[model samples]
Target: MQSLKEGLLNRAFSHIYVEKRAMEYELTKEILKRFKESKVIEIEHYKDIFSRANQDFYLQKKSPKLILAVKQNNLIYKGADVCEDFGNKHFYYTSIMMNCIYDCEYCYLQGMYTSANIVIFVNLDDYFKEINRLLSMHPLYLCISYDTDLLALEGLTNYVKKFIEFAKENSDLTIEIRTKSANFNLIKHIQPQDNIILAWTLSPEGVIQKYEHRTPNLKRRIKSIKEALDRGFRVRLCFDPILYIKNWRDEYRDLIEEVFSNIDADKIYDVSIGLFRVSKDYLKRMRKQRPDSIVLNFPYDTVEGVCSYDKELSRNMIGYVYGLIARYVEKEKIYI
Candidate 1:
């Protein structure tokens, strides 16, 4: 259990674990008071926080600030086609939360924002409004998590559960909830939704052990997803940001086998493949904070502001992973 403590907004907050039984009213009140001036992008009753204009304002450097956004009436957004389309339309993603709890060495948040303190959007209804507007236009594939893993933070906030309920009610839209956390207790409370897909980013055990910090191990993560599937949840496997590690193919091959053997392929909604990539500017900031991290030290090419594996290598890696995964799932169910 993590305890929530108050500190100056300028200082980085040490991780606080508040026990479920010890969630006192005073603590919530004090936290609300301390973060009073943070900002309210929008608030809705039934939906989570939609969007905030000031989100990019705090990305300059890591300073601890409590961001609490309560979504009120409008929750959904008419998503732009640019967010989901890749190669031609562009990769589309939407974030209901502002940041993440785990600190992966290769994560963009370290370079994307300065503060470690989390921002909770207390409202959920307003976001639904925006989503409704978008669904009316086309058969939309919406990435519910682009920035933060709402499922990881499900213990603290039930926003993901509520969102899952919303997705089940509205089957016209495709929603993807991507996360690395292995919190399974939260899923027990809800029935699985067909249109809502739970995508887990599968990295080799060595890669996760070496680079991912404060995240669940591969075994625990796989077990969690299995639990979701046992309850009929639509599961999606994502082998993204394939690292250029030694014996990479052997490691990834074993991982692919491990995942399919443990979970049912027929139940899988889709599979996504991508190689490691980060904005060059973001990588620079990550290096300064973690000077010895190998993720920052890797050789990469600059495309626009993003640092990535050579184009040929990236293409090959994506192809290889996609092919391997295709062995278990149909091609149409595979998304790269």
Candidate 2:
């Protein structure tokens, strides 16, 4: 018999929700093969299960089920003002998946989605076609894996491989795949492309252990970034959404030193810094979902429907971190 700790550590989804149309695709079959033990339940639409009322996002996260579905309308959206556009005129983001594998206490997904189950949109051709349409007019900058960690799901989804191939073929389309995963082995074989930026969101070790649950440690993420840089990939370091914790100045300062120590500062494509901010609606939902999370319980100020640190504190935090990072890299290479 498996010990209690062993059972918890080895806990995989025992249930999988499949859209009836998704069964027609090979990707769905491939994913199902990996989760052969999971009981498959077919449904007409993913939203039927995903958008249900009063679903326990917290409980479902314990052993979240997987949903394979075909994406419908609104495949691509203009990037939100909250995100850094990096001077791209045509900044946009797409959700090939909803919800993330990691259960970070500060993640907005808890408030954005009613359920915590991972929803994988199996239809890639539609997304690519839409991008091609947009590219026909002008150059495009898209974040493909913004909603979920494609690298972490590479073993099952292989979406990262497909997106990389797509980017290679379309030189006009620049893609940013952001992740907190240390799963570099998944893309180690693929040659890096100039237009593709693999952005890694690094948090302090203390923050990761306390608030960012299930995420790779700071050292592991830095190591992954170093490996990616060594492999000729254009890597972007994101210190955005810097949480306010005890001794935050020292924690983040030490983190920056550790990052530059392991990775070559000159090789980084760029660094992005932003203080923690969430939509007013999302924060309300998050508070209800995680009542005890100190990361989410901060007395943030609401500015135009977004909740974040007060102007003075926000400026101080961003300025301090930016100064620390600028010491290692050129100021022009850092984005606010």
Candidate 3:
């Protein structure tokens, strides 16, 4: 058996698959510098590796590889129904990368993608150009980091900084960068902009310890949010996808209290409260991936292809949390 340290070293990007075209990009070159010891293999397209079959997602996640490629088409997508649009008429989301570094047991990425290896598109200029074209028509509310946690991978991709600068220049564009990472050093130096909303997803400490693998604890994330608020950034608190655990109400109540005690609610841009929901197909696939996971195995009701708690349970969950948050935040700024 391999020692734990040796196993970790083996899993940490032993090989890097780079597209022949992406090899020329400066971002690709910078990423290569960080993994000099890993073997570099050139491919014609990233899908050649990322879309392969018979791959074990769980095993590959032990030490996922890196795929650097250029995005050729479909730069932006319409936001899904499950996602909160915040009443924006021109709401959309774009994925510069796929698959997250963290191993959250309830993450939808596990079912959405066939591989656990991370894919980073090196051509972000193209994404910005597409956004600019859309902006020409009307104002846009874009979610820049939906499929992956861009902030956590900021050291390798530097996309968060680039997006912040992009949002700073385009006043008509409001970008939401949601993350569970505590890597505040990446954005501490840059000045925050009103158009750029830094949204952090918070879960109870019990949930974080049980389900959210490799993610920062609740306290660390709160500290990062405090720093962002102090720097004049528009911060949004998200108690989304509140897990249904034993004593969930008490757990979440304590979580809310802990959150409010640390920061001033007046500075918050908004708060979003949502109960757990996932696509019916995605949940089916998730069940096949990890059949033993208690969180994934819940018997949720399906409505129009979306699986979630029964209507009454979901209503109570959202309503209870909404009531808790409303005490600290204004009702007008809260979204369900």
The best candidate by TM-score is 3
Residue-by-residue lDDT tens digits, candidate 3, 1-336: 546644555656779999999999999999899898999999999999999998878777778999999999999998988899998988999999999999999989988888999999999999999999999999999998899999999988889999999998999999999999998778899888889999999999999999999999999999999999999999989998898899999999999999999999999999998888888888888888888999999889999998889988998898889999999999999999
| Order of candidate numbers by TM-score, starting with the best | 3, 2, 1
- In model 2, how many backbone clashes occur? 0
Q: Candidate 1's residue-wise lDDT over 202-303, tens digit each?
A: 899998888886689999999999898888888888888788888888889999999999888998777777777887888887787777777788889998
lDDT of 2 by residue, 233-301 (tens): 999999977988999999999999989988899999999998889999999999999898888899999
| C-alpha lDDT (0 to 100) for residue 149 of candidate 2 | 86
Candidate 1 vs candidate 3, lDDT winner: 3
Worst 10 residues of 1 by lDDT: 42-51
TM-scores for all candidates?
0.76, 0.96, 0.97
Runs with alpha carbons beyond 4 Å of true place in candidate 3: 1-9
Better of 1 and 3 by TM-score: 3
Whole-model lDDT per candidate: 0.68, 0.90, 0.92
Model 3 lDDT-worst window of ten:
1-10
